[model samples]
Target: MDAGLLAWGRAVKRRGGKIPPLWYFTDAARLADPLPVIRRLPRGLCGVVFRHDTAPGRLALGRRIAALCRERRLYLVVAGDARLAATLHAGLHLRGGRRGVLRLPCLVTASVHNAVELARARRAGAMLLFISPVNATKSHAGAQVLGAAGWRRLARLAPRGHRAALGGIDGRSIRALGQGCAAAGAIEAFYFNV
Candidate 1:
């Protein structure tokens, strides 16, 4: 199978109307035993996103994650490094910078928190768009939250089929988005906070 298609197919399968539970581990220490937690997740647990935090052995750990995903038939997303993603088997998720990178037609995702960012993601031709701050986040204390209604509205502004919710998302809220999600076409995934 095509590596890119396989990755995208897995993404769609995980997110398609099912409102899969996604866990993003921004903490560096979690990588030591992420697989054990990942393997035990229910069907809703689709995958994980590894954020950049100046940790050690990230590349090696990311490579290990790629191996786990390949072995388990699960998905692994690497944020902020298109080159690294392209090199590894895991999918690429672009959050901030988008220059000097060649589009690989892989399951590429971008962060879109507002109308301007959404438009920029569309222009960048991202396969999936991640909209965040849907609820008040403990990590980002005092940050504005988009809430459900705001998320739906922002998603509508994006291109026809390309949007996913992020930031302050929990299992319960994800269930709600799965039920009456407004961005019907674009929201193929929910990168939730687990």
Candidate 2:
């Protein structure tokens, strides 16, 4: 993990509350085994978005991750699975354009790639929005990048203290983003050298 990126993640926060500045987003293909990485994350004010959507035995894997988060005091959000999240008593992370309504009382987050998605997430009652493609990323190689300016534009549309920078976010890029984002989420940044 880059010390600069970690520092940036730790320092950025909303005015009213301290959202976990650093978010570890798990990928089934890239980060098959996330336990070791999760263990290495700095405790407190850090979050894990477990996104093993199609992997076999995902529920079992989520349970393990959830256990680690509890032990390490890391916030855990199971992506795309309300039942599993509820079972583990963890938060929920919705994918692109998904509605976020849930009866369970948990931290609800969503991914937004454009203005429409951003508006939808807010209406669905997502507490945080992970704005993506801030820069070119291997995960979405050909995807259009938001760059610094575009990201700021979309982030500005989000509710204050509820926007998180995602996609190709690293120490250098995040520094460029300044205070536009309340938090930052990454899959490769935390697992591999970026």
Candidate 3:
């Protein structure tokens, strides 16, 4: 974690409120080694969603990340890997429209790109939803993005109230969300030393 990020996390952690809905999604392509960043992140201020299931030795790495999360008082969610989620007693992350049920002790969250996906995630009992492309992003280069106004419209569709705006979201974009639009979740910006 960058010193600024750690300071930000620690400052936010001191709020003594509900866990911040902000999340950090891990991507191997974004950062070859994310452990240092993960280890340095502020606990209780951000959730870490491990999503490198296809990478070599992913299971072992996931286990290690889960353990680090536990030790640092950070919540971990295993993306698209129910078995790992279960084994680590962590939350499960599902892609948009990926249907699944989680047993007790495991919370469920999903990524949504539109109102339909938002509705699907809500109906699927997702406690939190990650809605993306608040601005142009590298991952989906040249793709249509949901600007602030569009995001606000789609945000109304989230009944569960725990949603984060991701994808090319910078400080300015977050301010543009206005009041109650959503929280901020990031991948490259949050974890890749960008």
Candidate 4:
């Protein structure tokens, strides 16, 4: 982890919140094997958003990751599958604008690209909102970049301490956001060293 990110996580911890300050979002295409990366995550203060979407043996992978998360005391959330998340006893991360009801007790988060999606996420009772494309990223090539200003504007729409800056985010970019979000999510940033 970057020094800035570690510091940010520590700060968030000091503030007494359940949300982790740093997050790792998995991409099957970008990172075929994420166990090593998950092992490298700082204990207790970081979260992992397990997003293998279409990979075969996803449940097996989720179980492995869940075990690792529990051992490390890190938060874990499965992307787009409520049943899978429930089975793993982890949280659920809904994609942009998908309002999936949760009947079980677990953390519910959502990704929002715009104000409309943000409102919908809030309505769905998302405990956290990941505002994406804060900077140029290869993951979503040609997608509109929010930049620093746009990120701040959208982040303000969400209640304080419930927002996370995602997409092309790094330690430097997180600093530039000026504490705009309570947490920060990244794919490349965490995988670079792996």
Best by lDDT: 4
lDDT string, candidate 3, 1-194, tens digits: 33443444454446444545557788887675568878876666778888886789887888888889889988788887777788888888878847555553667878889888988878877777778788888767897889988888887777535656778865556667765544566776575444
TM-score of 3: 0.86
lDDT of 2 by residue, 28-147 (tens): 888778888998898886899998889898888888999999999999987888888899999988888486446568888888899999988787778889999899988789999998
Question: Per-residue CA lDDT of candidate 4, range 1-194, in tens?
Answer: 67767787788778878888888999999888899999998887889999998989998999999999999999998888888898899988889957655655788888899999999888888889999888888878899999889989999999998988988887778888876578988887786477
Which candidate do you rate higher for TM-score, 2 or 4?
A: 4
Clashing pairs in 2: none
TM-score of 2: 0.93
Question: Which has the greatest TM-score?
Answer: 4
User: Model 2 segments beyond 4 Å from truth?
Assistant: 13-16, 192-194
lDDT of 1 by residue, 45-144 (tens): 3556656446677788677777776666555667777777777766666664252166665665666678876776667766567777777765456978
Model 4 segments more than 4 A misplaced: none
Candidate with the larger lDDT of 2 and 3: 2
Q: Name the regions of candidate 1 deviating beyond 4 angstroms.
A: 1-26, 29-33, 42-45, 96-100, 159-161, 175-194
Candidates 1 and 3 compared: the better one by lDDT is 3
Q: For candidate 1, what is the lDDT?
A: 0.56
lDDT of candidate 3 at residue 120, scale 0 to 100: 83
lDDT score, residue 74, model 2? 92
